[model samples]
Structure formats: structure tokens, C-alpha cells
Target: MSSSKLARMAHVCVLALAALSWGAKTVTYDFNVTWVTANPDGLLERKVVGINGQWPLPVIEVDKGDRLVVNVHNGLGDRGCSIHFHGMFQNGTNEMDGPSMVTQCPILPGSSMTYNFTVNQNGTYWYHCHTDYCYPDGYRQALIVHDSDAYFAHDYDEEFTITVSDWYHELVEDLSTEFMSLYNPTGAEPIPSSFLLNDTINTSIPVKPNSTYLFRLINHGAFVGQYFYIEDHSFEIVEIDGVYTEPTEADMLYISVAQRYAILLKTKDTIDKNYAIVTVADSTLLDKIPSDLQLNNTNWLEYNKNAPHPQAIVNVSDSTDLHPYDDLSLVPYDHMPLLPEPDLEINVTVYMKNLMTGYNYAFLNNITYTAPKVPTLYTVMSSGDLADNPEIYGDFTHSVVLNHNDVVQLVLNNGDTGSHPFHLHGHQFQVIDRSPPYGPGFYDYLNGDPVPYDPNNHTAFPRTPARRDTVVLPPHGYFVIRFVADNPGVWVFHCHIDWHLSSGLAMLMIEAPRQIQERVTIPQEHYDVCRAAGVAFEGNAAANTKDFLDLSGQRSQPGWIPDGFTVHGIVALAFSVLSAICGILSIVIYGMADVKNKQDSVVPLDNPNEVVVEQNATGQTKT
Candidate 1:
């Protein structure tokens, strides 16, 4: 039997086993996170983070109600790791949310951390390493929560989890150094070397002639968003970011990083020909497109073994030329109405600025997020009555305290020129309003200043708004989202672009802190891992156990550059001026000395037309 066939049989067996238990049961995965080499793009072989010594880490599958226990042993010897189950509500299990220094310390090399949580949600989701640019190294894969009870489950004959990613020839560590350097003053994101489908180039998925197939498409890349489509075929969008949407027909979709979509594609009735599955990377997001880099990748739907599989003929002058269906127009399948007037509104504008070090950093308003010395969740668990105080989490963490069950509205204004896909942990929020809707006009704001959302002067919001964990904030535009703060945990709201995220484009929402204190408990293994990693398990952001308010030695982002002149800037300027003066003085002295030597050596000539030549330095004389 072929390895692919055996793999399919194994997947079926797991699904059958999961189905056998109607009631909720535990699904355990023992992952030994290690380094493995792979050349997915065929251009270069590089080290990647894999599970159980396997590249393209295993896809975690479980039923909707099953409890998932991922016991991760960080065998990557050189790096720390943590797993964030993207789009999981996590509810009372905030520690399991898995952002290092936010919920728990990183599972350091040679340490173990078990993520034990209930899979209460359904639809497509993913799991990835949330520690310091780790997922880009290949520590991510689709995490499917099987729902036999889905509304459209009976509509599709079969399903496939397809992942589209932007590939890089270099590792993240090297790229990060170049990205966060003085050379990258504008914070131009590194362009990808290639785009991939199912982690490889030119792959094919065999299909039946006239079958309805559910394709769970995930953009698990680090930086670029991708426009996805199938030639001569259109798909019905059924879900976005795990939220079931009313089936809307779309010929193409623009899936940003960390975003997901579930589409029902009906195959062509005739099996004589094959169709190309095309994914075009959003070239507008890149600062420069390398001549050698491929912006588009084509896989296929193989209907016949002998049919000619041809490459897709891309006609777009730019990726934006291909219009994608606006996700903001999608209505949730549940038809959940917008919540009542928000009890609290948090308005933040995204900014990109160079700090004192002259390296560009991303920010929310005037603050850039910096991880605290102690994990924010640990601080919440440790601070007796001060858990509700955002100060305990430190100033640089950009912490916001929220009342339990209060309707929270978040207005995100993009001050930067680039579009950012913002993702929220713990809850899927309703996208209430956005300007310059997702089409040809999406880039309209690039010609002028950013347009902030005006609550009173905007189009009426959808009665039943789209609810998703991730939404793209248009370039130089704004978006408003609302959700009930019912999930008590320290959830992060941040841009999904890994580069931006690494540069501090994130903030923590401490929702129902008092409830979090009462509901959540740190597992002993987590504490053990903290000890093994030499991280503080109980304390404030500064690790001060005595006084939560005294955040004296907490981690902080680099201070902003002051107007006019800073002391360091002035000193640097003075040094530069002095060096210039010295260089000029040396040149002048040499030129004057040369002139004097020539004048001293010259003898009077007998005739006016005659000239005297003399050599002095080498002790040679001429007349």
C-alpha cells in the first residue's frame, strides 16, 4: 500500500474512534517538538520545527466536545517553544491559551508543558507555536475539530484541510535580525521566496467527478496574505475563522495570515480535464518583489490520471486586481444580532515608529507591548485582590481590564500605510463596521491620511454582523468590533503578521480578572516547567510578590524619540561633526604640505617657457 493510502486509513481510523464516543472524551497527543530539515519549495533545504521528528507536523483532529491534552516536550534543544491553539475560546483555561510570558512561561528546551483543554468550539482552526517567531520555522498545522452535527455536514461528500503558506529560504532568527535593524528603518516586511499549497509546489488532490467537497483553507503563513481561487470554479463560503457564515458564493478569497475559511466546492461533472488551484500572494503587502520569487503557485484537482495538468495563466497586473469577496459582508449562520450599546469602548490606533535605538517598532497608540517579567496570568493568579488592576500586569504590556459579561467595543484605527490582520484570542467578535470595503477601493486611503471611525457618522452596521476571531484592518483605515467579555482570561489582541507582532503590535485584555482568579488554576506541570526554565511562577509583572503595584524593574519597550533633540542624538551628532572636521583638517594639511614642498623644490628657469621639476620624498633630483 502507498504511504498516502496508509495515512488516509490512519486518519479514518482516528475519526471512527472519535465518532464511537458520542459523549466527550479525552484525545491525547504526545508531541516531541524538535528540529527537522525540509525543502518544501525545492529551492533550499532549511531547518524546521517538527513534531516527533516529522516535517509538516501532524494535524490534530478531535471531536467538538472532546478534551485535548497536548503534552509537548520541547526537544528543540536550542529554542523555547509554546503552542497557541489559534481561535479557541479557552474560556476558563487561559493558561492553555499558550502565549509565552502572557499565560505561561515558554516551554524551554528539554522541558515539558501539557495543554489540557476542552474542544468546545467547532469548525476550522489551527495550532501554532506562539513563542518568539517560532511558527514560521514550521511549528504549525491545522487543528480540526470534527463536527458531525454541522449544519452543512450532510451537504459535502468529502473534506480536505488545505493550508496555504508563504515560504522563506532563511530561518526566522536571521530574518528577524535583518528586520529589526537600523537598515530596515521603514519596517518593510521581508518578502517571501515562494507561496505554497499543502506545504509543497504543484501538488494535486484527486477528486470525484461530481461531488460536493468541503475545503478547509488556512493561511498559516508568517507574513503575507494570499488570494485563493480555482480556475473555472466557484466555492460557497460556509465559515470564517471558525464562525459559520451564511453560505455566500465567492470566486476568490483573500485569506490573511492566521485566518481560516471553510468552502463547499462542487466539482465539475465531466472528468476529462483537471482544474488548477491558484493562490496568489498579496504582492501589495511586500516592500519589494524579487525577480526570482514566484508570487503565485498552482496546484490542481486531478480528475483524470492521464489528463494534461497545465499551469494557470495569471492575467492580473497586480494581486489586488483580483477582487476578493469582502469578509465584512458575511453574515453569521446563527444570525446573531449585534449586542446592545457597548458598556465599554476601547479605542486604539496602530502606529509604526522608530524608537531611541533607531529600529522601527509597531505600537497601539503611544504604547508598544512588551512582555512582562512574570506571565500576566501568573500575576493575576498571584495578586490577591489586585488581580483586577491592570497595573499589576505592567505599563508596557498595554493591559486593559474588563468587567465580566460586559459588552466591549474595540475601535482599531490603522495609522500605518499597510493593512494588518488583527486576531483576538478567547472570543470571536462581531465586525460592526469598516471603511473602504474589501475590493478595488480598499487601497483608497493610501492617497491620503488615515480615516478614523466616527461612531455617529458611518453606515448602519449589519443587523446580524459577521463574527470571526480575525479581521483585516484596511490600510490607513479603521474597523469597529464588539464582543461580550464573558470569557475570563488574559487574551491578546494583536496583528497576525509575525513580524509586526514581534515588533510589539499587541495588547492584553484582562477580562473578568476576579473571575479568572476564581476559575483558573495553574497546573503543577506548568509550574514545574517554569522552574525548569527559571521563570517566576508567582508574582507581579516585575516579579515582586509583596507589592503588586510596585512594578519597579518590569520589562519595557525602548522609549520614544523626543522632539528636537535627545541626549544620545545630540551626542551622536557631535561625534559625527567632529569626525568630519578631523577628516577635512587632514586633507587640508596634506594638500598645503604638498604645495610647500613643490614651491621649495622649484628653481628659477632661464627662459619664461622653461619649467623646473624636482623630486624630494624619494631623494631623486631633476633639472
Candidate 2:
């Protein structure tokens, strides 16, 4: 072999050694937070949390049923903190719901909480700080809960845990506090200077030719929605929210905040080719926009800078030498059983309007931010009232009407200046379309009609159709989702961001249809009281009449009503017949008048008297 070939081999050998050391063991671990300066190499210095002095805490992999403990030691001297596990259902037990003060008390400074919960699920999941006012860069980690059979299921030749985060060179605390204190803020809160995909300050993924690799992807960015994909080659989605599906394929997958996805990919055999996984701004994901920005027609980038979008590329080396291991960690979907499906569709749209300020604004369809009311206004007010008012100045987001048994085709259309992760209450949806003309914030600039119809290009996310609680809709693009109206009751659907939902991005979905509601029996005393009080039993007349007849029938025969109620039925029939006759006579009279007018009109002029004016050379007209 030549010297250059030997050098290349040596370089690859060094990388292999690094990966081996990195991949040696996967176990559950705890981390204590420590404050560190962000933009250590950036122009604007900012502060963030470091895990045991590392920027990112190590990936934790634990088996199912294993009791996991996460001791989050709050190192920041000024702020209290807690961790919220995204997408983990712990039997509705509030003990595991790590809200800073509501579900559980905050872990104050110099203190920590040992959050214990069973690893009941097996898919992509994440953990992050739930403390308010902490910026997006404060603290977060990826927690991969492996299935019980994960070890013996498939032997992956190569596996990578690639995480994408939005990092800025500014203090999150200061930014969030400042924005909240503003009388009327315009655009989004400021973002950090850089975006990191897989720990690279600014880099892409490099792939070995003809080799496959498993990528366990996570989106822990505080608020931004991300799109994860591999250019050219498709990504086979194996799991989402830490649940395995029947291995679905897609060109790209969008990940909302607090959501995770795992994918398998095999690099192309051809040499010198590069594939890119990108996150552009997604307008479909935003809650609402300001009116002034809309007036000025602000572009997506000018409004929101740190949209959680990061991209990596797999580069194929063109040398004659090719890697022998063609298999990536992605297990082949050889003989998987078919899976069940969802039953409805919920359509979502992300739009923005310019507020009359120097700053721009956003909304998830129609919801915006607000402070939690004292005595909890939601306790006394109706759900409808809470949905109509905005605690902040943003657009409407929860503008959906759903009825039970209505199989939904939830389509999310991005009409805003930025991207948003459109999440639902009780289900996940199939992604049906994504067209391109990517805007500045990594949002897709695709068109869509208002109706809940699926576009043709996009495919379903893996394990999604099973019962997704959340799905990300790219900006400027629309997503088509189908779910069953299974859960009856008032459910909330909105952006997954705690602040966004708290603002006004949430609304209630009453699943009771008209017919089902009519079955509710009213007390006779209450009905009599309503009648005496002049309550018009307008819409309920049909049911009231039917009940009256049934009571009369019960007093008489099984097949006939009593003589007393029979006269009422006859009177109603006579009124109906008379009304029909009157309507018909009215129509006949109108028709006759139209015909008479047509007959009485004079003959139309074949040609009116034509007047011709000829202009002479001296500007004189001759007719």
C-alpha cells in the first residue's frame, strides 16, 4: 500500500478507537449542574449549565422495568430547578410528573431530587430542566429506554447517538426575564449565536461507503421544532417517543421540543457522495405572529433565529477501498406483523400577524402567552372563555372543532413566519406531505388548502400510527394526520411548549356529538321550571314531542297513543301540510311572475341606430 493509503487507514483507525471508547458501555447516570460560559469562542458571552463539567451529559441507556434515578443537582446559585421527562407516561402518577412546583417541589439551589421511575417504555425519550425563566441553553439530556429484547434483537455494526441542540451566546435567564417584563414585546426572544448538531459547533455527519448506521435522534431544544433527515438516502423510522413501530420509512422526520425519534440508515455504495440532514425554519409550527411584522412582511429569519434546526451529512469516500461492514446498527425489517391504525384527523395551521410594534410576534393558530391567574381563573370560568382570551399578544392556535366517532385527518399548514411543532392531545398522525423552498428559519415554504387533506409526498413516522401524543408540523409546509376520536371528554391540543400552551395556544375538544348529547335525559321538574320561566324548548322540540307521545302511549296501548295526545299529532301534521302548500304556492307565484315578465318584454333591437363621427384634418367632426 502507498503512504497516503496507510495514512488514511491510520486516521480511520484513530476514529474507530474513539468510537469504541465512546460506545463501550451504556448505563444510567446522574448529573449535577454547573454554570459555564457559553460562546467560550463566540463574540457574545453567555451562561449555560454544564453536566459534571461536560457540555452534554452522557447518554443513559437502561432496560425496561429498571428503576431509574436522576439526581439533578442545581448548581446555579440564583435559580431553583427540576426535570421534566418528555413523553413518559408513569400511570398518571403525579409523583413522576416533575413540574417545578406543581407536581413536585422545586429542587432549590445546593439541593437535588432523586427522581425515580420505572423504565416502562422502550423508545427515544429525553429529560430536561423544567425551571421557568431558564433559557433554552440551560440544561437537558437524552434518555434512551431500551426494550427488554433490545440486546438480543439485532447486533448493530455501528451505532451513534446524535443529538441536535440550539445553543446561543446569551444568558437564557436574562433573555426570558427581559422578554416577560416587556410592556409589549415584538419578535421572538433572542437566540444564541450557534446551533450544534451532534456536538459539532458547526459540522455534518460523515458516513462510510456501503455501511449502515443507527441514529438515535433527540430534540431537547427548549422551544424550537426540528426536522431530522438524511439527504438522498431515506431514513427508516424504528421508534418514536420511546416506542417501537413496524419500521416506517421517510425522507425526513420532524421532531418537536421534548420529542425523540430513532432511525436506521444504510449508506450508498457509490463513492464521493454526500447526504445532508437539515432543519430549516418551520412556519407550520409557530403559534402566532405580530401584526406589525405582518405589515412589514418580515421574512422568517428576521423573526426567530434559533429555530431548533441542525443538519449533518454522511460523506462517502471515493477511494478504491470500501468498508467491509455493510450493516449499520439499523435492524432489517424482515418479517414484521401488521399494526393497527388511528381513526381521525385533526388539522392544525401555524400562522403569524404583524403587531404594530418594532418587534414581530407569533401564534399557534390562535393561542398566545399569559400569566397564570390568581385563584386559578380556569377554576371558575368556562373552558370556552379561557380559550378566547390571550394572556399575551399572539394569534389563535386552538381553532379546531371535533366530534366523537369522527375519524380525523388532522392537517397542519405552516402559514406563519416561523416553524412550530403541532402536538395533539391523545394521538399521533401520519405525515403526508412536504414540499420545498426552505425559508431562513428552516421552515418549509409549501402551500396548502384549509381543508384537512393529505399531500402526496410525505410518509408516516414510525410507531406513529400506534397512538401518537404529539407530531411536529414543519413551517410553510402542511402535515396530514389521522386519528380516532376515541377519548370522549374535553381534551387540550396545543403546542408542547409549557409557556406557549400556558399563553393561549391551547383549546378544548368536546367529543360529544349532537346525537349523543340529545340522549341526556332532563328531569321533568326542571323541564317544567324551564317552560314556566319562558325557556323556548326550541331545538329540543322534536325530543319533547316524542316523549309526550311515548307517555300517552304508555297510558294506552303498546302500538297506539292515547286519544288526548292523538289530537296534537293531527294538529302538527295539519300545520306541516299547510306550510308545505303555502311554500309551494309562493314558488308557483314567483315562477308565474317571471314568465309573465319574459312574455311582456318588447322585441330586442337587432341593431341600434349607428352614429358615425368622422374627424376632418382641422379637428372638425362630421356625422
Candidate 3:
């Protein structure tokens, strides 16, 4: 071949390789979570956990195939925190999946930890602290992952993320204790004082005439489901829970807690006319909300920015507040073409009862889920007891282990008096079917028995099923969901309502434990996290491992900054997983990879106020 012809062929090969590998962007964020007082609704000053000193935290926006690396520095005094990225299928990076006491120990106070994961998929999601009642204290943020494969491009010119939440006057710290106490008589969850759009009672969205805008909506509330609509605009739903569905139109929609929707708003020629954005609390499920509190709110969708903001012209109606819409009509763009018959089925019954201590709580399978004293991941890995002896974890932990590659089906039969919004981490599942509140509310039993969630029935579900990470389980009803046990790690399947979660209405899906133990190597930094949090990993069984990590030499004392400030300490460790998809930038981490036993290490500091222990680079630690 001639020299020129050889060079041209080489150029063509380089171009082809470039086309094969393009979208691999790594996104980095520095988030500092601290306790501050902010009145989002402008009514009362309540202490809230804010990210980077902002109440609603920051909206995370990124394109698909981007790596998400977040440094969560918890500055809350004496409060341990963990954040769960709501619906990410944390493939192969289960350590980055943040569910406190499930995946890893809580990030200790005055300590920073890095969460590195990849967003290979696209959709609307949210991030919130998964520990205790921190989310109700305003530790939530909207996460949007964009892609080029959107089918609704023709209907929208631009996009906006709007969050609707139920706002309360009192701090969650003040109310959660009473709500879960044994002495509480009323047994009613605390009600919200107001409802907010984008963290404000009055939200004004300016729009142009003859333009289409995609409004990415998120229900970031804790207690109540919301029904929202504009007075004059009829929007078409294009996506639900980060999955695009075939375009469907509705006058009003009810969104459950932690649910997301992408609606295309087609602006009309009603020039200079302002429409009311009616937001009302659908309290039909709850029998008790403080009568004095207001539940109806009015936001604005204005065509003219100069027009004075108008009050709500439409009535706060309960038209679509009956129940969540049927997912059978909504078609998911990409998913398993046909629902598979489950290899394993679980009948999870939700109950309401007073415990032995007289505290009212919601129960799954007659047992309320409790936070494990140890991070279940470490427990499973170190002891190898999850598969052999799950009974050791007991009923409170509710850790269910499944073998690899089993198709799992869950039947949620609601035995409680109120509805719940259930969410699963890791993967989205197909909503197989649901029963009406008494056989479609007709004389249907006259024809046959009210058949609901029977495993023997084959024709119960629609041919095509709805795929989502969250679904509303109505009271006195049932819901069926199916998913494959592919991701090998511990994932949370729980109620998204903050109150219910605090009340122990949550369980763990320890998928493919044997495979997880064989393929996945628990990093030393994860054990260091438990060491910093003073949580014991190996409980009953003896294991061959170093007790603690002694990095280098000992330093004199501990140091901490107050109120949203960053801290560098022995627990300030970062790790990097070098995979083909993305990489983590590990900055100034000492004793992260190497493991050694600490001679005089005390039990992990349960109190953040404990004396600061320091370690030098010589593998020696000192207090």
C-alpha cells in the first residue's frame, strides 16, 4: 500500500473508535450538611438540615453516563447522617449506595465521606438522607439525569424541576420522638402547617406564549400525597418515576410521596392572563390532620411577567384524589417486554398495632423493621451469616436473602388504616396488578369472589406492566410487583413517608448474598467508617480480620468547625473504584487502603463530642 493510503486508513480507524466511546463525564459535588433554622413557608423558624447552607439543597443536573461523586460532610451536631440516591440501580458499586445501617455506617459528625457512583441511565430522581428523621428536616434535593433519547422533545422548548412538599412548623426532632413514643395517646402523625412548591408557599413560574415547557415534577414531601394542576392548562404526562411513558393527558394528577413526573406544558395564546397552580393535599388516606392547618395552596403559571401575581381562582378539588392512577394504561418505553413468572413470591402484609411498649407503629409481616446496630453489609460480608443464619439478624432487621438470578415477586396486602408510598432501591420493578378497594366498589362479588393477589392466578396482570421504583399501596388493598434478583447487594424496600420509615416500616432485600460475598470485596474504608461511627461489624461469629486501622503516627488532638463548615479528621477517608465506566478522585485520604490493627482504639465514638483522636502518616494513632 502507498504511504498516503495507509495514513488515511489509520485516520478512519481512529474516528470509528472515537464514535464508540464518547459519553463518559464525571460530575463532582461538595455538599456540606448542617443544622440551620430556615422557614421555607415564611411562617415559623424551625431548625432544618440544609446542604451547603441552603434549605432545599442544590438541584443536581447531569447528562447520562456521567459519574456522580459527592462528598457529604455532616456538620450536624451529634447527628449521624446517610444519603440514598432514590432510584439508581447501583450496579457493581453497592458500597456507594447510601442506606444507613444497610450499605454502610453513617457518616459521622464532623467527618466527610465520598459517594462515587455512575448514572448510566437517565430520568428524574431525588436524593435524601436515609437516616432517622433527617429528610423531614429539609435534607432533600432534586436529581435530574438527561439523555438524548427523549421522545417528547417536540412538545417542550425548555425544562424546569418543581418540587412539592408538605411543610410543618415544628422541627422533626421535636415531633418524631412523641410520634414514636410509648406514652402518646392520640397516635396521630404530626400534620403539616402548609404545602409548598419548590420550598415556598407562593411559586410563580413565568412562561412565554406559544411555547412548550417540560416541567419535571417531584413530590418531596413526607406525610401527604398532593394533587396539582393549572387552572387553564391541560398537560400531557410524558414520564413517570424517571421512565418515559407514552404521552397521556390528564386534567389533574395525584402524586405520591417521592414520585416524579415529566409533564409537557403547552402554553396557550391567553396573553396577559395568569393561571392558578392549584396544589392541594389529598388527605383522604389519613383520618387525622390538624384541623387548624391549611392544606390548599396556590402557585402561579404566568404568561406575562409584569402581571401581578393572582390568587387561586380554581377550587381545591379532590377529583383525581381517589387513588393513584392505573399503570396498565401507561406504557414504558424500555423494559422487560413481558412479565416473567416469579420464581419466588413473598406475601408482605402491612399492619397497624400497638407494640409491647404501647407505641403505635406500622408493621410489615407483623414485624416493624428496625435499624440494625451494625451495617448489614459488613455483617453479611464478615460473618458470612446472612445466608447460613438469617435468623441471627432477627425480625426487626427483616433481612431477606435471595439466591442469584431468582425472579422475585412481592404481594403487598395492606392491613393498615392508611395508605403508604413504597419505594425500592437498586432497580425499578413492574407493577403487575392491584385490586380495587372492594372489588371495584360494585356488586362484583355477586358474580365471583373478590380475588386479589392470588399467586395461583395467571391472568391477573395486564399484558404490558408499569415500571417504576415507587408505588402507592392503598389501605385495605393489595399491590403486586415483580423484579429479578440481579444486583447483588443489600437494598432497601420501604415506605417513602418519613414518619413511616422512622416507625420502622422498612425491609432489606439482600439479593444474591452468596454471589455478593464471592464477587464483591468489602473495602477497608467501609470498615473504617464503622470504626469511626463506633459500630461493630462482626457481632456473634468470630472473623479473621484486623480490629482497627492505625494509619501512621499519632497527632495531638481532634479539630472541628461549627455550623456548615468542613472538617478533616481520621475518618476523612475517600476511595476510588477504577472501572471502565468512571473513576473517583481520591483526595488526601490517609490509611484508606492499607489495614492494620489499632492497639488502644476505643469502641467507635458513639458520641460526636468525644475527644478527637489523630493519627500520623507512620501508621500510629493517638488521642
Candidate 4:
């Protein structure tokens, strides 16, 4: 073909490709989850209704700028429901904040609300009901927004979403119709012995022999931390909580509630065989691991003994295009930057008590049992000097006080049997350290005399510092986190549990140096109208109205600067001819002194003719 014809053909192909992959295509998904009675099993159950009947809904995807309108029809006739998109910035759209009763009225039973918002962020974020615990199962789903740039896109042979959830057989409503029942005196309904990984379906993703697959793991389970591992393969974690991390290989990871992780795996095993994707309690963590962990062992020892090396449940196809959203990683929001040194340390205690018995009510600190009323060593130190001073214990509060500009170092202790997923609002934090009660032992210290962790040459990674928004505080374990108290609003910091929060397990965090309340601008002459309507104003009321005050050009803060000595104004007036001359003289004097010192050190290069002249070819000595 002639060169011109070849060029024309190439142009046509380029245009065709561009047309096929031009702008992002918009997508919207519909879902429904409802409470149902369980048979024979003697427990309450919830099944996903609309899309694929699964709890915690499906993984829905959209590209940046895609207009998404999700209409959640609350079918749980018991109470109202609202879906809050956690960690999502709706560009200050209050409606998108999804406050069940505050931002907008909740979707009452037999009614539905359309949540219209643009997908503007690319990271891991989720949507869950923001109402009472009773109506929870129906209102949870994973919403993923893809990055705009194509280079960051991922490629995988196969992909599947792993949604881990904790189940309770009793309708949260049966426990207590009143929302307060979540924390009331009655014991919580029996929590399931085993958690579900992906709606209780035997997890099996088929891949061709020697092919790689991707797993998008999302943890929205209320209580415990989840650790997932493939039966035979160590995976590469490429993304975390929806943000891509610097890729690293690990056998497993600890996933707290409301967080997500994405891992890639390459299997050398063949297709059409069965393999187990095992999930176990991160029981080794400081906190209590569930006693009864159900592993998928249908065929048991026999299958393990003679099963082919590369096992697969189904024939995997070429999935190179499945990881459409892989390259999208966690990009920092403008407000998030490397934090400055923290100025405050808050050590909050987690406790468990048998409401019926006073004996069981105890405090947890230093991996031992203590009376619940007593304070920790840090608390005593903070209160005052004497260790056993009555005054110190009398007025002492466990909470850490913080000023607005103060950076905060929050230490969370999970001393109870149940794990707590701690989340901080208005800011993300960096995880600095974690120490399980057992330290370097197989069992927790509660079992007595645990192995000590070594200070050096230890493979166990501690203090693996990284930025994170949510962290699972394992039972009988502790974590240290640091963040700046920058965002001034009343931010809620608590376990992301509808039940735990309502039970007084939550506390208020006050950011001091309260934001200065800006002066309200009232329109001029409006006050007269208000007075006519029986409203009164002080001092030239009518003139003080917004429009009048603005029109009069009153200084926003009249006393901000003393009458004639404005900071910038004085500085500008001082830079006159005299000041300029003085500045020039200072520079000249400094330069001359430097030159004289250099000449004095030279010793006049012995004999001018034989002088080692440090000069340019032009014979001009250069400095």
C-alpha cells in the first residue's frame, strides 16, 4: 500500500477506536433487601430481593461525572430508612449527606426517595441505611466510582466482589421495636456463629490454568474484623478500602467493618475444579475472636488429600477486561495532607458489662481485669500529681480535651470479647501502631503468660504506618492513630454500628478554639419590616439591616486593626526612597566585605608572571 493510503487507514482506525471509547457511559442499578422468617434453622433471615437476592446488595460501578439516581424503596414497613454514602464528597450537597431525619425526611414505609447525585469520587465508598438498627439489612450496597484517566485502569482475567456480613436470625425489630432497644437492657439477639462471605454462597471463581483473578473485598459487617485467604494462593493486594495501595503481596489482611480491599491472584491450577476461598476470624488480634468459626469443609479431609493441585469450581474465561476499574487508586482530597505533629492524645476505653449483674461490670486496661469505675494510669497522671489522690479520681474524665489547632493522637483499646470497628468523621487518620494482648503468642494473654514480642529482627510488622479512615480494633487489642483537629464542625467519632452507638457507647468529641461565629449580614430596612411584624432590633435597627449595613459600607470588623496602623498599610508606606537607599547600602557593605576576605586569603599568587590565574579565557578573574 502507498504511504498516503496507509496513513489514511491508520487515521480511520484511530477514529473508530475513539468513537468506541469516547466519554464514559452512565449506569444505574436497582436493589432491594427485606427481612424474612427463616425455616427449620429457627432464625430470622434477610435475603436480597431485586438484583441478585443477596444481603448487602451488589457491586455497582459508574465513571466520574456519571449522573446516578438510586431510588431506595423502603419495604421494611417497621421504620424509616435513609442511605448515607460514607466517605463520599457530594460537593457540599446537603441532600446527598443522607441524614435520615436531619438533612431530609427518611423514606417511610410504602414510600421511596430518589437519591440523585453525580459520581465524582474514585475510591472505595459504600451506602448503608442511616436509620434505626431494625431496618438495616435492606439498605446496604457497594457503589464504586471509576477513575477518569484510562492509564490507571486495571486488567484481570476474572473478577468477583466479596461482601462479608454478620447475620442475626431475629428481626432486629423483634428485639425491640423502639430504636433504643438497640442499647436497652435486653440482651442482643443471638449473633450468628459463622459470618457470611458473599451472601453465604460457596465462593468459587473459576480461572484458566495459570491465569490471574481479582477479588474486590468489602467489609461492612457490624462487629468483627475479617481475614480472607485463598485455599492455596498468596494474593497481591493492589487496593485498600477502594484506594489503590502500593502493590504488596500478603497471605491475609485484617479488614474492619466499613472498609474494603482489592486483591489480585494468579492461579496455576486448572479450570472446572473446586477450590475453597477460606475466611477465618482474625482471632489472633488483641480482641476476642469468635469461638465458633465455620470453615467450608463439605468434602473435608478426603478432598484435601487427593484434590488436584490447581482446583477450580468453574471454567474461567479470558477476563482481561474484567478489572475495568483497577487503576483507580486513592487520591487525597485537597484537605488531606501529611499531618503535622499531633497535639492531643485521647485514650478511650471499651468495656463490656452484664446489665443484669454488677460483678460482670468491669474495666479493661493493660490486658487485665479491674473495677469498671477506676481510671487508667494515663487518666490518673492527667488528673493531677498524686497517684492515689482523691481529687484526681473525683473530677477526672477519661475523655481527652482538644483545642482547635491541636493535632490528636487517639488510642483505642478493644478489651472486650467483641471487635469494634472505629471510625472518625471529618478527618482520616494514620495508623501508627497496634498490639494484640497476646503479643507474639498463639493465644491472647487472657489465657495466662503470653509470648513476648521482640523489639528487633521480628517479621511481625508493627507500626506499619499508613493513612486510613477506618481501622478494626481487635478485641483485647489496641491501636494508636493520629490526626489533626482541623475540620471545625461537630464530628462524630464512634463504632460504625447502629446498635452500639445508640447504647451510650459513643461519646462527644469537642474541637476547641471554636470557630469564630461570622457576623450575620442583615439586609437594610428589612429590620423595619420585621419591627412592623412585632420584631425588634438594637441600635439603628433599620440601618443595621443587611442591605443598609452593606450599602453603608460599615467595616466588617471595625476594631480589627487600630484606627491608622493597619499591618499591610504601614508596611507599604515604610518602603519609601529612604528605606530603599538603606537596604541598598546594607547589601553593598555585605558584598564588599565578602570580596575583601576572599582576596586576603589568596596570598598574592607568588610572582605575577608565574601566577596560577583562576580566570576565564578572557583573562578576567571570575568569582
Cα lDDT listed for each candidate: 0.91, 0.48, 0.74, 0.48
Tens digit of per-residue lDDT, candidate 3, span 373-454: 5677766676553354564444466768777888999999777656688999988888887665322341222234324466
Q: Write the per-residue lDDT of candidate 2 for residues 1-623, one digit (tens) a residue.
A: 99999999999999987774542333345777788765532345556677787765566677665667766677777776667666665432334445432233455667655666665556677666654645366577777766546532373446667676555555665555554432323335444344456544444455566666778877666565555544466766776655565566666555557666677777776654344455532234333433321100101111113233334432322111112111111232332222344354455566543332212234545434221211011111222222222321111223244555666665566664344555553343333333331223232243443322344435544342344456545445555555556443223455665444433444444343232233222234323322433332321111122222121211110122235544345445556777999999999999999999987754455667765566878999877
What TM-score fits each model?
0.89, 0.52, 0.80, 0.56
Write down the lDDT that model 1 would get.
Answer: 0.91
Q: Which lDDT value does model 1 have at 400?
A: 95
Instruction: Determine which window of 10 residues in candidate 2 has minimal summed lDDT.
Output: 294-303
The ten-residue window of minimal lDDT in model 1 covers 566-575
The best candidate in terms of TM-score: 1
lDDT tens readout by residue for model 1, 1-623: 99999999999999997786568889999999999999998889999998999989899999998999999999999989999999999988998999999999999889988899998889999999999988998988999998888899999999999999988888899999999986667788888888888888999999998899999999999999999999999999999999888899999999999999999999988988999999899888998988998887889989996899999999999887889999999999999998899999999999998887778899999888898988899998989898877888898999999999999999999999999999999999999999879998999997799999988799998899999999999999999999999999999999999999999999999999999989998999999988998999888999999888898998889976779875456446656877999999999999999999989866767898986776778899876
The reply for model 1, stretches above 4 Å from the true place, is 1-21, 565-623
Model 4 residue runs over 4 Å out of place are 1-58, 65-67, 89-91, 99-106, 110-119, 135-138, 148-152, 176-189, 281-338, 353-406, 415-417, 437-464, 484-490, 508-623
Clashes of 2: 78
**Winner by lDDT:** 1
